[model samples]
Target: MKRFIAVLVFAVVAFSCSKEKGNMVVKGQIKGLKKGTLYLQKMNDTLLVSVDSVKLFGDDKFLLSDNVESPVMYYLTFDGNTQEKKIMFFGEPGEITINDNVEEFGWKPGISGSKNQEVMDKFNEINQQFKLKRLDFIAKDMEARAKKDTAAMDSLEKEYKKMVRRRFLFTTNFAVANPDTEAAPYIALSELFDANLYLLDTINNSLTSRVKSSDYGMRLQKFIDDVKAQEKK
Candidate 1:
């Protein structure tokens, strides 16, 4: 009888322990950011951590998963900000926490106490490719226009827009898919259009808004003044 009771007690503890460990899913959208890469990191002790990143899709949704331990805290970082969420293994699965505000960087799910380093390097290489293509288009267009070659100029313009659209799609997709992150990558792609006149008409409105809006325009003017003032002083 003593041995049987001990067996039953051990079985109960084993079952409870098994139930306490399970998978957790995190989902959220990045607002006001059109393109960028979002990173999910698992904290390791002593300034070490394992990191993973997801590309943001056009719809601005992101998902991350981990096998959680009870009372564990993980961080959701986007752009340059980080938010904490305390994971409770006792609750139902599929719980969600959304980090929406980009300024204060508030968290929807509370009861979190924490804290990663490192950025995604793959996206950087792709961005370099985009810059090279953009420059090539600009130089070709300039030479064609200078020679009075209307047909070649027109062709270059069309090709430039097409290249821009492809970059937009890549950035938009990554931004939407990882809404919990920033749109820095997508914003960088916007700079490519500075040399391509043909892009102003064909590119997405969001990309154009960044270049032409009073928000950016006023800031740009202020920047120029600040630079000039510094030069004099």
Candidate 2:
């Protein structure tokens, strides 16, 4: 019968539409979202690519997943755009939960269930203190410059350079401390890329065997090699 053939086609389509059970499962809620698409994205060779997406009609909750071959940074993006709002986190193989409001989506979204993310949080907490000090130095330097105080300006300039070196040393030490986590190499790649070659070498050498094989770890290694090659030329 025609009715039986239609039912068979419907069943086939339904089966094909079933969601995949990827290694990394991301599930969470955007408090004010009612009708929009959410994309789970990551960088693939310098291009941001969306691996999975979901459309919510009336609910604030959503679930998206991707097959993570190695731990890498993943971006929870809104409406397929990363220019304005996106939550970045160190993604690994496991169930991770994210909760945030659309108004302050990228400002301070809560992320959990990834060890690398926790390591990143701790590093950022201390790094923020250094940032605050840098801002204070900038204010004082501007004030000294406005008054045309040459002696004071020179003193502040030397102090600012020292503070910058201190911050770089702190980052190098922190990355060396978390050698077993992917955050270690990620920190080196993001925060200390322009640091002294020796500092980069120290962190790269200190990475754990597993972490050295991670996505960022490999990238860090490549970056160091490229820098060395350029130095020779």
Top-lDDT candidate index: 2
lDDT, candidate 1, residue 105? 44
Q: Per-residue CA lDDT of candidate 1, range 47-84, in tens?
A: 52534455665655666555644223245565544344
Judged by lDDT against the true structure, how good is candidate 2?
A: 0.91
**Local distance difference test, per candidate?**
0.48, 0.91
Tens digit of per-residue lDDT, candidate 2, span 110-221: 9999999999999999999999999998899899999999999999999989988999999999989999999999999898888899999999999998989988889999
Which stretches of candidate 1 lie above 4 Å from their native place? Answer: 1-120, 183-233
- In model 1, what lDDT does residue 125 have? 48
lDDT, model 1? 0.48
Candidate 2's C-alpha runs over 4 A off are 1-5, 8-18, 80-82
C-alpha RMSD of candidate 1: 16.7
